[model samples]
Target: MIIVHDRKDVRHEFDVPEGKALMLQLRPKKIGIIGLCNGNAACGTCHVYVEKEWLDRLPDPDEYEAEMLDEVAERRENSRLACQIEYRADLDGLEMTVAHRS
Candidate 1:
């Protein structure tokens, strides 16, 4: 189960199958997350702030993803493009807050 905290303070919980992209899981829910690049890592529309505790657990963002993160508002140590984040069995119960667009 991945727990998403939207900008409106609403908590959305859903089952994230292993190997699925986080963006794919979110886009259909209409919770305001957008994967503008269709999970190609070309845009920051799916930006999200991972919980501080889980930050270290995720792999470091690649160069392309890092560059994209810079274009988003509220970029932080935990900031990441959701499209680049994949679901894994170890990531069960992962919690993240969707970043608001500027």
Candidate 2:
């Protein structure tokens, strides 16, 4: 179960199957992520702030994702592109908030 919060602070919870990335899991759910670049990490539309407890649990973003993240107006120490994170069983309870666009 991945828990997510929207810009309006609406809480959302859903099961994320393994093998698919986080963005793919989010888009179809209409959870408020834009994913404008379709998981390519080229746009910052899929930006999210990982929950503090789960921040260290996810893998570090690659250079490309890092660059995209830098472009997000709401970037923070916990910010990450959903496209860069793949689902894993260990991430069952991961939590994040969709980043607000500028």
Candidate 3:
């Protein structure tokens, strides 16, 4: 399961399979994630914040994602695009906060 919080403080939880992209998980949940580039890594609209405690559980960002993160507002050490994160069983209870708006 993954927990996500919106700016309004609304939260949602969803089950995700290991090796699946976070973006795919959000889709079925009707979460308003803006993947403007359609997972092509060409836009930063999918930006989100990985909970501090779970930051280390994610793989390092690829060059494309790293470059895009530079353009995200308020980019932080834990910021990442949902498309770039592949779910893993170890991340069963991952928590993140969706960017208010991309």
Candidate 2 regions exceeding 4 Å error are none
Candidate 1 clash pair list? none
Q: What are the TM-scores, per candidate, against the unseen true structure?
A: 0.96, 0.95, 0.90
**For residues 1-102, what per-residue lDDT tens digits would candidate 2 score against the true structure?**
999999899999998789888898898878778788899999888889998899788888899998888788968999999989998999988999998887
TM-score of 3: 0.90
Off by over 4 Å in 1: none
Best by lDDT: 1
Instruction: Report the C-alpha lDDT of model 1 over 1-102, residue by residue, as the tens digit.
Output: 999999998999998789988999899998878898999888899999999998877999999998888788888888998899899998989999999898
Poorest 10 consecutive residues by lDDT, candidate 3:
24-33
Q: Kindly indicate the candidate among 2 and 3 with the higher TM-score.
A: 2
lDDT of 2: 0.88
lDDT tens digits by residue: candidate 3, 24-76: 66855656677878787777777889999998888888899998988888888
Error of 3 at 5 (Å): 0.6
RMSD to native, candidate 1: 0.8
Candidate RMSDs in order? 0.8, 0.8, 1.4
